[model samples]
Target chain A: MPGLEDLYREIILDHYRNPRNRGELESPPALRAEGFNPLCGDEVVIYLAMGGDVITDLKIAGQGCSISQSSASMMSAAVKGKTLAQARSTIRAFRAMMSLHGQALDGHGDGASGGGGTGAVGPEEDERTGAEVAAAEGVSLGDLEALQGVVKFPVRIKCATLSWHTLAQALDEAEKGAGPD
Target chain B: MALNDFGPPLDVARIKKDFPILDRVVHGKRLVYLDSASSAQKPLPVLDAMQRYYETTHANVHRGVYQIAQEATELYEGARAKVAAFIGAAAPAEVVFTKNATEAVNLVAYTWGRANLGTTDAMVTSEIEHHANFVPWLQLHQEKGTELRFLPLGEDGTLDLDQLDQLLDGAKLLAVTAASNVLGTLPPVRLLADAAHAAGALVLVDGAQYVPHLPTDVREMGADFVAFTGHKMLGPTGIGALWGRRELLESMPPFLTGGEMIRDVRLDGFTTNDVPWKFEAGTPPIAEAVGLGAAVDYLNGLGMSAVRAHEQALTAYAMRALKERYGDDISIHGPPPGSERAGIVSFAYKDVHAHDLSQVLDQAGVCVRAGHHCAKPLMRRLGVTATARASFSVYNDEADVDVLVDAIGQADALFG
Candidate 1:
């Protein structure tokens, strides 16, 4: 079985201790979305400032476990200054990396990420997923890949992914030009 | 029939043996289960009784003509009597077995609330109640436009009942928890029940936390209805009891309609069965009921007072240990170590998130519940998103607390 070292890596703890881009943004320009892990009552709020389909600035505001807080911190650092499409691809790659274990070990994906494309079904599917992950390697998960260990502990996967879900929701709202309620 | 004094104090080592899960080694360390508030580890007797029921007396209850069927029906009804006697209900018929205490409260909200409440009617609950007691009333209010009010929590971690009379003034029901699951604050339930009665309002005590820890008497509690689950009390899951006043249950309609909970039926409309049975529709959790009966027997053998005493002492030790070790760094969110609370000790250690604390503690084979504890409104009242709660049961002792304390110290070293 995987140990605590696997779950709480040094970089994750560093990110948790000194979170990046931690605060709220003005709602008029910054799209905000709140995500909640109903299982544990962990809440994450994502605020996005878009400059013409590019994420000009991103700030995360909320409280949760080490996984969640560090993830939000890492996510802000990763997605900031990236184009919308780049950010989306990064989110997908990060999610895919996090869910890689759930697919291989648990034969299921975390419900937040629909489980089909990257799931290794047979030899051919495994090769395709390998290629897909290699392509996502170009997207560069960077420090976000530190959360890949969260999958060993399935319950904490939601914790690590909560900020991502909120970020996705914020992007969705940005696309819709919807005001933060 | 009474909360009889079985004998001496619970021999911790002996008691630990009864719960086989205690023998488990998690992460190469001895299991130290402190999450009994979430669900207690079932004793061998409870497990064995369930298995024995399925092995020998597995048949449809109350519909048996054959010998095995009759035995099954007897066992099922006998379990009801055991639960009734355990809680000091007037009769077995007063105990309505449900899927869990949540369903029991829902049964009351659907049946009694539907029959008695209307738009103008108001129901008073407390901030510390589990969502089981709180949500059903809220649902009643939402569906029927009934007004819902809350008894606020005081600074001392207990309900501020100074405004109890005013809150229950025109209320039809006072739905509250006998104890706060998260804070472990044992509200003055008897006093609240009496006040509700004086105000001409029925009281529904959520005993999911209370019943497992204390010697309960529905008559003495003066509650119209008391809902408690089995899983938290060393019994199996999927079986809980709602002890209601017989007359009130008789007056209300059936909550769930189906096979077993009927005396007569027509194509147009069907007549519901007796008080408890009327609420318990379809095939009940027969084996689970048997397991609960065995659990009641186990607790009775341990003696509820003894069980309470053991938990009280252990909680005191845990509180003292935590405070002594962590000083101002640890904040235990409950009544200051005493009988005023159950064994639940919800705490936040030096800004460590509950999940993080629990995960670290898990490495030391210490299991604890880390969340809102299903009391979100209370979490908001406490001004925290979640807390790491370590609750004690009959089996838990000083050693378990020491293990918990040591593991928490490890967490402090790691996260400090």
Candidate 2:
């Protein structure tokens, strides 16, 4: 019963119109990874400039739907200038929020619903807000919480997660190619 | 039905009553399905035929000496004959039933292609073919080391046949689509067939998109092999057919060798069955074949010429509507309104991504396909990552096009 208003929030639309860190970083200094959602032909390229366990800079390039582009923009803005551990935790928390893995993230057995979600949370629905999920993972979502509405539409979940997956790929590759520190 | 430039127009309102799914409501709006190119909605007769076959004559075909088994075999074989007649095949034995059109293309590639082609041989196809036709030949090139050549696409979304003679030269086989699934470009199959013939090569036409909307005659088109599927033509998903010349089919070895495909099993080897059954390996999609037979009957009743004409008129109306409403804001890819294109209308509205456009259209119960359409090569040729395609069928009319245009406008308003 979720409407388009819930999926395409003003914040998401604004982020899509003006993407953050929208360019390419030189490959010699920065690691690049690409992700593709073959279903919708959504491609996300993540460029990460790492300075010894800290992500000094991040840039995104590609084309896709509003959900994907906005998610990529929000992700770039959230993770930039953060430590490697902080970025990884943010990635995990954001994935958990988007996938509605509330039960696993919360760890507590009780079904206490988290507050702060602006949309209608029916009694039958999974009521854990993105903030609560992030809090459980010991990280905050900030503006990326706008993408939590994508959970209502399962198909767009891939679109939202595509950039994050590519970022993770960039991190993994960067670490692998790094020398003894 | 009255005569028009396209042909005798179809009675869409009357035909719409035949498909039960046409009455469905989505998002509190009446369903306006324009993804018929991806898969057409099944009519009542096709559904009834499938259910009736399962309820009354449920048995494995080409097996058992009992009366019911014989009846089952008759129905299954009868379905093959109907499919052959639908496409104007020379004989029923020339049509080999496979899982779907993809499987049919692979069968030809593995059997006829692998057997005849080699490292020196060159196989010519087009840039506009679906992955089903493209990948099989690519695989052939990879394994057999055969040279692969593509007929380039022109700027106007048609194949650049000016290079046809050069590409066809020294080629052993030419595999091409009868219609481009993404661009709605109807390639000149007869012309291509003749050119390939003069080049001393065989022709395989991917008729998956063509057969459903247009009147298909394998012989008239001069095709040695024509591949089409049931699902896209209002039949069930599991059944499809490849109609080849009987001599060509008989000459090729069995692609999948097992029980039904063999005449007799020996200790060392087995003799294969005759022509079509020689390629049909195991338990076939019997009920689906029966449904396909019923679909053929339904189309025949409506007439294929009428179906083609209906889609042509609808495509023309949709083109005019979109241009008139959007003007410089919308870009439609493919041949112009009258250039013998199929009913597929792939468009990019304003700056809206195809996925976003489709999502908004989904709210209004307008189902369209938004993606590379399994034609990434063609997408690249068209200089786009994806496009929102609205295809028409016998059941769709002008009202459907109107709804589609309005929904597209809604997308533009929201995105803008």
| DockQ-based class of model 2 | acceptable
lDDT of each residue in A30-141, candidate 1, tens digit only: 8888878777888888889998888998989988999999999998998899877777777657656665423321212234444323333332223223226637556667
Give the docking tier of candidate 1.
medium
Report the error of model 2 at residue A12, Å.
0.7
Worst 10 residues of 1 chain B by lDDT: B1-10
Q: What TM-score do all the candidates reach, one by one?
A: 0.94, 0.94
In the range B1-416, model 1's lDDT, one tens digit per residue, is: 13244357789999999989999999999999999999999999999999999998899998879999999999999999999999999999999999999998999999889999999898899998898888888888889999999999999998998888899998889999888899989988889988998999999999999999999999999999999999999999999989999999999988888988899988888898877888888899999999999999999998998888878878989999999988998999978878698898999999899999999899889999999888899998888999999999988888889888878867755577
In candidate 2, position A60 carries an lDDT of: 95
Candidate 2 lDDT over A82-171, as tens digits, reads: 877778778757755765443322222211122223222233445455566568767779889888778888777777877776777777
lDDT of each residue in B121-215, candidate 2, tens digit only: 99899999999999999998999899999999998889998989999999989999998889899999999999999999999999999998898
- Candidate 2 residue B205 C-alpha distance from true site, Å: 0.4
